[model samples]
Target: MTSIPDPVEGPGASPAVPGAPPPQLVRSPLSDGEWHRLHPLTPLLRGGLFLIVVIGIVFANLRDRLVFIFLPWLAPDIEDEVGEWEGAGGDPIDFIIANNLYVLAGLAVLAALIVLVAVFYTSWRFHTFRITDDDVEVRSGILFRTQRRAPLDRVQGVNLTRPMIARLLGMAKLEVVGAGADANVKLEYLSTANAEAVRADILRLASGRRLSAAGPAGALAPPRAGRVATLSQTVGREITGLIEGPEAPVTELESVVHIPVGRLVASHILSMSTLGLLFAIVAIVIGVSQGVTWLLFGFVPAIIGFGAYWVRSIVRSLRYAIAPTPDGVRITFGLFTTITEIVPPGRVHAVEVTQPIMWRPAGWWTVRINRLTGRSAADGSTDQFTTALPVGTAADVERVLRLLQPGLPDDERALVVQEGMFGPGETDTFTNTPRRAWWIRPLSYRRNGFRLTPDALLMRRGIVWRKLVILPLARLQSIGLYQGPLDRASRVTNVRAHVVAGPVSPFLAAVDRDSALALFDGVARGSVRAAFTDRTHRWAQEETSAPEPADLVRGAESAPAGASESAASGTGEDRT
Candidate 1:
């Protein structure tokens, strides 16, 4: 481990370059520049690559050098013992350490030079930054110092990182992302005050775009300075707001939601699986007392393992929020070291809403978005954040879906409601004795819907939680779609509903074979073209196909009693 270097003191310490307000100092145990130091694994990454390259180069040049050293040792080895080769080679160690000196010295110098260049570049070119009212400026560069600027509108997201060193340094590196930012924008390094000040000012300056929570109770933001008394306009107002009013900034924090204290602890620590810190701690204590230091170390981290896990759980389980902005969506999580992510809505190509076996009863949902460019955790990367709500309920999902693609069909509100019983809703809904079905496989067919006809059977079954994946003919990616052998033998044919999932982003859903072929022909032959076009086609300006018929019963399923406001109110009660 390297020793701590002295601070930049004495003569050449540059003055605080004028820019945004200096970062406010917070009471924290880490040191300046502690955040940017490479992760312990960093050197390994570079060193591993270097080792390969260096070895290849050394081996390439080894023959000539080997001959030079071996000439002297050849006589001794040949006389003393049966040499492997015809020559008497010199003392292996002596020869190796001798002539290898030049090669070693050259390597050392090259490495030292590379290190010097990198450090110089880092010191001179590196800088942290913030956007100010007048301009978005940066202080960066190593040997050749620089301070550059652009307009605030040109600025995009501000990424804050605390490299392992930065964590220890008590300071953070800030990068102001923009359309065309410099490669190395680490402007001001190792300055805790500068970081916070820069971050706050940038936030305040662009305060116009701060994210807010959804719903009536969410943001208590005051009206803008000029628009306070414009209340009864007799219509609706679509004014855009960036930063919310003063009251709910903490709501900007995603970890503010209240999880039942008991469940939060249990889910993260002491559930039946017992894989959380409780198990680790219990195991650690037992191992340590038994004088099994190696074993204890094997399971848990020495100084900070348990704390990290606890902190991670708190960050995930608390106040969760997903907001839609004009440009993109910003998702923030964590408490001590908060993470704020910004993803543009335009780039979003697909979305996945999943409920795992355990989460089914919890009424929790997790969503993941497929962006054309940004990295996703689902595929595999450090960036696994959801573009929309990653965790929430049916209502939350609805709100986010609406936000994701505004102006979606209002009539589909009922479709969304119908899906409540249909999807992974609250646990009590499924307590009516799980149904068992027998078909190709026991678990494959969970339930049977009343046969609309003998030739067709509606089967609903899943290994874990049951799902009703519907398939309709009109949305097939391939009209000539066919069924496989397994499906045909069961007298059941699997047909795809849509090649995609979602109103905005569609995916394939498999259904029985008879339904598949029938639907395919119906759609392919354009038999249901007129009706299908009218209902599913959002872009068409075609009029309603037929006149509306009066409801025979007042509270019929076709027309329910209360409005959406009432439904929302009932769901809102338990959300908090």
Candidate 2:
């Protein structure tokens, strides 16, 4: 219940020394460990429109009855003539009108409005959220109350979403993504400015940074206009954003990658979904020509569904852009309902770069990652959530990869793009599937391979639909080597790196048996070492002069003597 500071008169209000930089004012009011209500118009914004629609539908259905009830004097002459018709079919409302109980009916309507207002007011009052150093908590409901909390350490990422309606009202929602499924906590309908400030405060707290005290003397704070002026400014900004685009919450670094509309449209047109739709349409055409009319019913529904999905996909990627920030990667997407997701360092478990055969001509690739989204499959579109780069050229992919994996050295970045993405089996760096194993993977034998770096494991596969998966050692949960009868006969093995559940699959198929064994040993030992030395979880607190990539690679290669023994006895099962 603490009052927010008056921006013009609070700390940092006076002018500082002539040459000194302006002091940074504390912008967040909700981070003071007090339970705070959401936006004042949250109730109306959340369901007011729905309530109006429901009332409109009811009035439409009972238009005549309502007219008679409210204005009985006007319809008095017609009622007597239709009394017989009404007696047989009319309900309690008609009886009320017939008895001239207009006051009673009006009272009933008034009562309903009162109840609705009370409910909405109480709901808004009860629904409160609190932000502390440890976690973000939200409490709601009157009868079946529920409380949800997201711990700072377990926070996977933070998403700020502005739906079309909410954006019009200059409001945004904050979803604090936790480490496990369905663990996300949402603060719906906060003022846009406050939402941005709260997001920064939460991320700062999660990053192990303490809030600064009020500014020193002569440090002038930014001026603030009156509430009326502020409201006008917010409205203006929202209107401007509709024509332009939503502004980013944080200061983005240079070199941001933006996908072109033409490329996005073309990529989807040549996608597997489009191809499947084409085949379905051909089948439908053939069926129609063969005098099968019943197929049209099914085909129409399928077409509608496919069209809807395709359009949604394109709309979501309309304003797609990705850039780096001090926290991690900032990804913005969507045309109407803009979502800005901040994925901090060390959250990404696995990264995959894939190229469909059709996209190969354009040298375009799609990048996705495996990370804890704190949402179930049924909650939302997990595909869109996991996709980092929807459709971009090879250069765009490289730039996005750098943002996603900031620790990756220049040499490793080249290895990822050159060897993992486009290189053939002739490279010495990658341990490829042996020629004897060609029968099992005839099409991709020359392209299938795996490479190791100090920070991650890279698995490249497929010729028609090329894929490269990168799994960071620190995030790896377990490693496994599989060899079935066919694999053994082909003198090859399959390796899988287990991580969080997501879109990226880390399984590599058809690797030379000896190379697979060596990979298993190295990964097991290196993962253990990486886990021990990993400091990315609290990156802000880590030492500035970290080891170079080459030194780390060398250290991984010449791991301690105990590392090998531990890895040999570890749970990396090599099943035959």
TM-scores for candidates 1 onward, in order:
0.41, 0.84
- Candidate 1: Cα lDDT at 283: 76
Local accuracy of candidate 2 as per-residue lDDT tens digits, 1-576: 333321121222123323211223224656656567888789987778778999999899776665665687877765664566467755776677568777898899989888988898788877888776678988888777788999888788999999988887789999999988889999998988778877876776677543253232221223677878877787888878977888644577443787788888899999888889899899899999999988888888989999998899999988888887766788889999999889989999999999999998889999999999998878676677799999888889889988898878998998788888988636558877888888888898878888888678999988898999999887888777888999988878888888888888898889988888778777776676676567666656645577664565456558664454254322243445
lDDT of 1 by residue, 123-219 (tens): 5324423333445555443445556665434344454543333333333455554434132233334333445444434433443332231112111
Tell me how far the alpha carbon of residue 272 in candidate 1 is from the true structure, in angstroms, after superposition. 8.1
Score each candidate by Cα lDDT: 0.39, 0.78
Superposed Cα deviation of residue 494, candidate 1 (Å): 5.5
Candidate 1, after superposition: displacement of residue 374 in Å? 3.4
Best by lDDT: 2
- Steric clashes per prediction: 57, 4
